[model samples]
Target: MVQDALAGAGYPQHVLVACSGGPDSLALAAVAAYFARRGHVDGRPVTVGAVIVDHQLQPGSAAVAAATARTLKDLGLAPVQVRTVEVAAAGMGPEAAAREARHTALEAAADEAGAAVILLGHTLDDQAEQVLLGLARGSGTRSLAGMRPSRGRLLRPFLGLRREDTLEICRVEGLDPWHDPSNTDPAYARSRTRVEVLPLLEEKLGPGVAESLARTAAILQLDADYLEEVANATFERLREPAGGGHARNDRTGIEQAGKGISLPEAALRDLAPAVRFRVIAKAAAAVGGQQPSYQRLLAAEALLRRHGSAGPVELPGSVSVYRLSLAQLEAEGQSAAAGVPREGARCGKLVFRPQRPSRK
Candidate 1:
């Protein structure tokens, strides 16, 4: 079933496997290797390279990463590279910060190996946990939908399978899985969810509860996909390009500064609530300059729904959107109720003013 999905998705070809020495990832790496040897998804043969990221948070992390690389080498998989990623303990919580760093490191390794697809080991269990977590945070449909099977260059072949199944496979394959103590520690919310919450939920609700949640996520994914399609179509009618100058449209830049975006008030009023939210999201992303967090998106949508308001709303540090009667742009935080300048006329042709000169 897993191999068929990879074949259907054109994955496990020139693949970079994220192996953390845990049972889930180790099983994934081994299974991918098995399929690669058979040339199931490739004309020439598939090449599997293992990438282990050392977060360097713990004292034994570097040695563990080295050992993981050696283990993969013993299994006939060459080491593409081992990377050490640093995460600052601020702004983002520890779990979120570590995840971001790990993904960044994995992407870098995949790029270095010239790999088109990167395999992760997210299982059905993880999907259930994510759905529960999203509910806890009161997030939107996207979060409730859980992790995608294939996002960008990343692919998770085991998402439909269970973690216990992977562990069983590892035992049968004679692979010694490395257990992370963090999984059992109560210090992390995920650990608590895995050890305490999931078990209680299972006891109260009976088995297959996790599976039921996984099924919910799958259904939500289909719905999300359809909604995104609608959003793309609506975006075509609603989008108003930013005036020239400001920042270049380079998605690769960090702290994207000096970009301009605008929206048509008439156009916004025509769409339904759902379509309106989607249009705002795209415009904020495209020209307002950065990807707003889920929370910020909701806040922006709220402000828009109320008063057909004009002016700025403060978001997380250093990010704001100016909803002028005529235009909107991503800028630093300011008072949302601030009076508009008389000269800030509703000129059909709004010009972009750069906050600062480009590095050049």
Candidate 2:
């Protein structure tokens, strides 16, 4: 499993394992060390290192980070580094903030270590839990897809392995693993899901439930990937020409992107609902808008005359979308109702623009 991941990554010169003193990450570190001793990967010379991030959330996080780094070094992994990060809520939950902080620390460490790829140790159980969380939130297909195997410079070789597999690895390797108290703390949603929800589910659904969810995620990933490619291409094609051209100097650059960007209403109306929704989201993102939630996307779709025309549908990131009215169409020299199509003609256009800030 590990070899496949390394080979797929093109056998980079250096790899950095993000360890957290947990059984999963420790098991990954051991495997990395085993590979490093070979002195080469896929006929290419390679080195392995470790980065232990201390979120400082618990009382002895620094001590745990130190111990993890020591263990990795003992495994013959070189240049072990400990990163301390400050996790701020930043309008998100503490867990999310901590994850953001952890990634930032890992990326900086990877750059400093000159590592080409950073390995994460998210097991199949974690992927199952992620899918469950996505389901609970009523998330879209992409969210239901769960965590990916490899994203850019990060790889998760352990995702195909179970949590028990990691535990057995630790036992056989005689490696002591820290059991995080947060894993059982009811104050956290993930803890509650892991402790209460999953066990109850297993009792009724059998042992294969987690594996089934993981498999489902793998399948959905393929579908989501293809649809995303289609949506990306469609978004580009459906956009109206800005300033008689699509060039940046056409006065429709990123800064002015949120100002009066238009998409053909008919083209959007013609698309499948799934593809259309994704296309709308892609456009919003092009104008620097945050990804709209599923509900927000539905609300945006409502303006296709499928629902009542509520003016100025506000998407996230201060962008608003609205279907053009007949008067507005006439103002733009578009004559659809008159049955005369001329240059720059269309039945209608959905305009996305920066919403004027409301007074406090």
Candidate 3:
């Protein structure tokens, strides 16, 4: 399975494993080392390396990183790096902040080594826990989809394997993996999910509940992927055509700094709610705004049906959407929103632009 994943990814010349000396990551490192040294990936010569991120959150994190690096070297992996990162408690909380910092460090390591592929060691158990957490938050379909096997430069070959499989592999390799106490620490939500909630769920709901959750995530991932594709295509199709506006559409750079994208109010009003919300979210993104919440999207939609109400439907990331009549644009000499109206057209245009700064 591990070899197949590398082959499917085209086996980039430089492959780095994000190892943390845990059983799962250690097992992954072992397989990756064998593939690089003994296996063939599209007959390409591959260099397998390891990166251990010391978050410095727990005491002795540096020591753990050093030991992990040494182990990888002994396992015949080349270019092992121990990158230390500061884990500040950002608004997303400690886990998310540490995750962000760790990824940044890994990215830096990959860049320094010119690696195009980075392997992660998340297993089916982790996927189950992630799904449960997503469920608790009443998240959208994308959130419920959980982690994918391949995300850009990151790949997880063990998503099909159970946690016990990695543990068994560690024993077979005669490797004593460092069990991070944080895994069982109740202070963390994931730890509690893994040690307590999952077991209780198993006792009450019977065995295979974790497996069921993972399967649900896999199914939802399929749905989410399809919706995103349809949404993007629909977004491009429904938006006002780019020409006829006064500005040369430099939408990619400086022009994008303030000017917003446009959608026809009539076109958006015709779409189903699911596709419409996704399209609205894409418009917000195009205007340098973050994903609007469901409520925000609803507010933006309400403006679509409202007449004679010139609204700057406010969204996050300093973005605002407006409903504009051709007359309104003509009076203000405003560039046609997104695109110019058809000659003698009656419909209004929806524009998304950056918010104006208040004067002191």
User: What TM-score do all the candidates reach, one by one?
Assistant: 0.80, 0.90, 0.89
Cα lDDT tens digits, model 3, 1-360, are 777778888878889999999999999999888877874566788889899999988889888999999999999888999998888865679889989999999899999999998999999999999998988877789989999999989999999999999999999999999999999999999999999999999999999998999999999999999999999998887665322333212232222134467787767776788888999999988867898877888888888776653666778887777677767656645454344356423356677776544422
Worst 10 residues of 2 by lDDT: 243-252
Q: How would the candidate models be sorted by lDDT, starting from the highest?
A: 3, 2, 1
Among residues 3 or more apart in sequence or in different chains, the pairs in candidate 2 whose N, CA or C atoms overlap within 3 Å are none
Misplaced by over 4 Å in model 3 are 240-258, 325-327, 333-347
For model 1 the local lDDT of residue 142 reads 85
**Model 2 Cα lDDT, one tens digit per residue, 1-360:** 878898999988999999999999999999899888887877789999999999999998999989888889999999999999999957899899999999999999999999999999999999999999999988999999999999999999999999999999999998999888998999988888888888889999888889999999999999999999999898877776322211121222222233456677767787999899999898777666899998888888878773222346668897767676545566655444222244223446676765443322
Best by lDDT: 3
Residue 289 accuracy (lDDT) in model 3? 89
lDDT of 1 by residue, 200-299 (tens): 9999999998999899999999988888899888777545545453343233232224555555544555567777777677765564335556677666
How accurate locally, in lDDT, is each candidate? 0.70, 0.82, 0.83
Steric collisions counted per model: 0, 0, 1
- On lDDT, who's better, 1 or 2? 2
* Candidate 3 C-alpha error for residue 326, in Å: 5.2
